[model samples]
Target chain A: MSELLHRRTVVKELLKKRGDMVVIGGLGAPAWDITAAGDHDNNFPLWGAMGAAAMIGLGLALAQPKRRVLVVTGDGEMLMALGALATIAVQKPKNLSIVVLDNEHYGETGMQRTHTGYGVDMAGMAKAAGFARTMNITAQKDVLRLRPLIDGMRGPLFAQVKIDAEKLPLVLPPREASYIKNRMRISILGPEAALHQ
Target chain B: MTTVSKAAKPAARAAARRPRVAAPRPAPAAPKPVMPAGTSHWAEQVHPMLVEAGIRQVGLVPDAGHSRLIQLCEADKSMRIVRLTTEEEGVALLAGAWLGGEKGVLLMQSSGVGNCINMLSLPVACSMPLLILVTMRGDHGEFNAAQVPMGDSTQAVLEAVGVLVKRADIAADVPEMVSSGLRLAFNTFRPVAILIGQRVSGAKDFRKLTQPAGDINE
Candidate 1:
């Protein structure tokens, strides 16, 4: 398996163990691949939807303290709403987990260079902003190493996964966008039974 | 004769002593007007308005015009007032608040309205509820030239974004407008703008109130 798919597979397996409110961002085909495998419910677009998912997750976690909120984000999109991390840190929702897919490019935006290309430490930033737990995984083996850490985390957590940009799969054009948007709305608002239909 | 003179002198002295003055009568005590203590304070008037509207989260952009309202929100524990670096940041913050299940309001000035035009697209596209409290800046004899362009177009821009805009030019209109805007925001699950005219916000002097320095920070 390619490095991108392998890392996604490991992350997906880890996420399946935890039952939480998960919001997936439009990173690349990996996010779509994971969602296709029925790993998460809500899949939000990341154009203007970047910083909002985490904030919404923070709110949901605060309102429903018994449940956890996990956000699957991309490096480019995360930078757009970086200040929100500081706000989240101050709020310190223990049930929040932010997983950043750092391929070092805006793969959705035609593979443009993002701040991550300038050697920005996305996980370190989250940690400095006050996330109690943080990790950076560069290999599929290290991705597997996160199972224990993800299981043991009690508060806000951040994880950055570095994968080969060229290895990440490209989703088929316009159809994928519509499918993700429709599926996300269904995930957020519709019954789980209706999702399969 | 000497005995008779002593009795007469004593009685005369008692009679001439200015009728025993009665402690000068305390100058009629100025009839201290029956003004209710704490009623004149703005916090008393504004805090209840926020509570009654159920406004728990407020995203603020600093403005001299909104100083009083901001102060009121800051003093209130029930209301979480977040000060943003820019007006658009405040709009984005409110959008997050809406998605998170908390109702939010943006507090800014007319000039800041210009800064928020681009960011308004997020709410419009997402179909989220936003309640914005705007202090009017440019029109109605504004002294500042910088505020003119945005102040003139505030209503038009808001209307273009599908936001229902209400103007409170008079003091009597403020409370009802705020309450109505809050209701509409929650009911419609879309943003609403309440514009407080310059005369209303500018007429009041907040500095004279002797507010505690650490009230807002806390």
Candidate 2:
């Protein structure tokens, strides 16, 4: 199976289990998968999301305080604003989970090597920057290992998932109409109420 | 004999009188004061200037040259010093801070400039303002060859990206230049660069505070 497919499956399952989570990605595979997932009640865009994913999650977390916020990030997207991790750490949001898909390259941009190739320790770096929990998962088996840790996570968590670089078939349509509908649904129903669906 | 006595008495009386005392001179007006000796870490002065200029967020990548400014920012609550893993990350943080209605500055060495070239697009694309305080590393008598290339390229690269660059050769120029750069950055909503010359921060031992505390606890 393709890495992208694995990622999409994992994300779908995670979202199915834990609803109302914010899945943010740049304009590429992750976004495509999110767009394929179709709209939840919330009308927010699932693809081509920019640097504000974690930040928006931060705002939501701060506003609700009791709700959980999951930010699905890409390696390229996360590199654009890595300092957001430090800011999140400082805030110490108890219900925030940041999952970075570390393909080691900007898959959207012709698969160029990012800093991850230079032995940049993203997990260690996050921990040193004050994240409460940091982990790295390379295989599908390890994804299950993270389930328990992510389940009982009390504070901000940073999980770097390493995946093989292989293209996957487009799972969702490009129009993003369904994602927009989900965003709208979530807005009207509220994060909590929307998650119950 | 009486006239002689009278003259002698008059002379005696005149001599007995004390000569008019010179009016006690008021202590000479204190000389105009001067800036105290050894009170001139450019970083120390720049820290307060940044605070006064409303730059509350400072993102730093540990560089020996920026030690003083980093320590100063760390000690200040009004200014939060976020230590970044890379110079580019620092730049991004500053950009985010700008978006959130807060002003930010990045302090790093010149070599780190290489790490920041690609990330520089964030400000240019978003129309967000950024203020970077870069320490010169390679040019003036630098022992590290790795720093020379970026040091040479720093100004041109930043200028190429539409960022206005200013050089502060002396310690005193830092405050005014930082203040002016910040104003211009906000007014134009563009990134600005203030490059600190090697001599300004290079020679100083900034690990310890120059001023001694009156009380240890305080």
Candidate 3:
């Protein structure tokens, strides 16, 4: 079996060529991962909200319709809102993708083991829920394959990206929710969005 | 007798008739659904106003209190209604929608309000527009004891989370309150809660909400 990839490295690879893609980072580590990938105006990182990243992705996917929407969240966070997998599939926004970093622990809450570590299958759930594309990535090479697939826009896609369970340095993104929101609005809708903020 | 194409009737009838699998049942003639007594139609009244105010997205968890509003959003071609498995998800959906230059509202019952305390922080933290239409439970002849505590404390709980609470107990007040809520949320960029009173949503008849899978003559 190939070695499990690092979360930051995996996120970096996925986000490297994300031009104009709207990236939604789930609370905690995934938010940090997006920042480590180089935070941009299009990045709307969740600082405190849990179990919301994917549905938020659904809303954005429905709203933008044209732009690619990516949601990066941890396994714990993903589990907290598993029904979203079904909801997203029903909405079937082809431009949206959910990349779950399966580190198998609640990294923010004292590293307690989560359901994924005990073999709860999120990718299987997504596939059963009718996601157009589903991936369970365990190696570095598989990460490369995703780049082209996401580019194809044959989504709504679900990827359970298995990564090392080791805790790493916290490379935090912007914490201010309003600031993160306004910048993302400006990026997506330009000056008109700023007036609302 | 009805506006919807008979969603709730068959289910309620299906629940009423029992042990139909064993016996050969006749073709059930569905009875005309009598709209609940004193039907406020508050939800029906507010649906157009929300559309008029440029609000389109609707995120909700299933509840009898929000049945009409949910149906209204579902039927509208311009509005996008998202059915949430839990109430807290609506908070994040609205936040995402607002950032994407769209407007939306959250519909929930009092019991679901407890599920949202943590996530509600996202809107308050961002100062984003969050408009919630809550149908209260545990008040005004509620049958379910479990819903009582959350219902009694819904306002205080919402206030503690920094939401501006506006309660409407009767049918007439709902439209104006909802409009004010939209103004507070969309114009002021603040979170406003329109707590629909128990009497308005007819919280007492909640047991008659959903029936079993099979059809019945009753």
Q: Residue-wise lDDT of candidate 3 within B100-178, one digit each (tens)?
A: 8889999998889999998888889999889999988998778889889999999999999999999988767888899
Error of 3 at B161 (Å): 1.0
- Model 2 C-alpha lDDT per residue in residues B1-218, reported as the tens digit of each score: 44557659888888778568865788995332233477766677778778887777777777877888888888898876666656776665564344334567888888788777766766665555788888888755566666678888889988997788998876667777888888887777678898887766553333334456543222
Predicted chain B of candidate 1, TM-score versus the true chain B: 0.70
Error of 2 at A65 (Å): 9.6
Best by DockQ: 3
Q: Model 2 segments beyond 4 Å from truth? A: A1-27, A31-70, A75-96, A102-130, A134-153, A160-197, B1-39, B202-218
lDDT of model 1 at position A141: 72
For residues A12-109, write the lDDT of model 1, one tens digit per residue: 76566555455544445545644544534454444454445555556545544555566676777678767767766776778777777777887766
TM-score of each: 0.70, 0.60, 0.86
Clashing pairs in 3: none
DockQ (C-alpha based) per candidate is 0.09, 0.04, 0.53
Which model scores highest in TM-score? 3
Winner of 1 and 2 under TM-score:
1
lDDT at position B211, candidate 1: 70
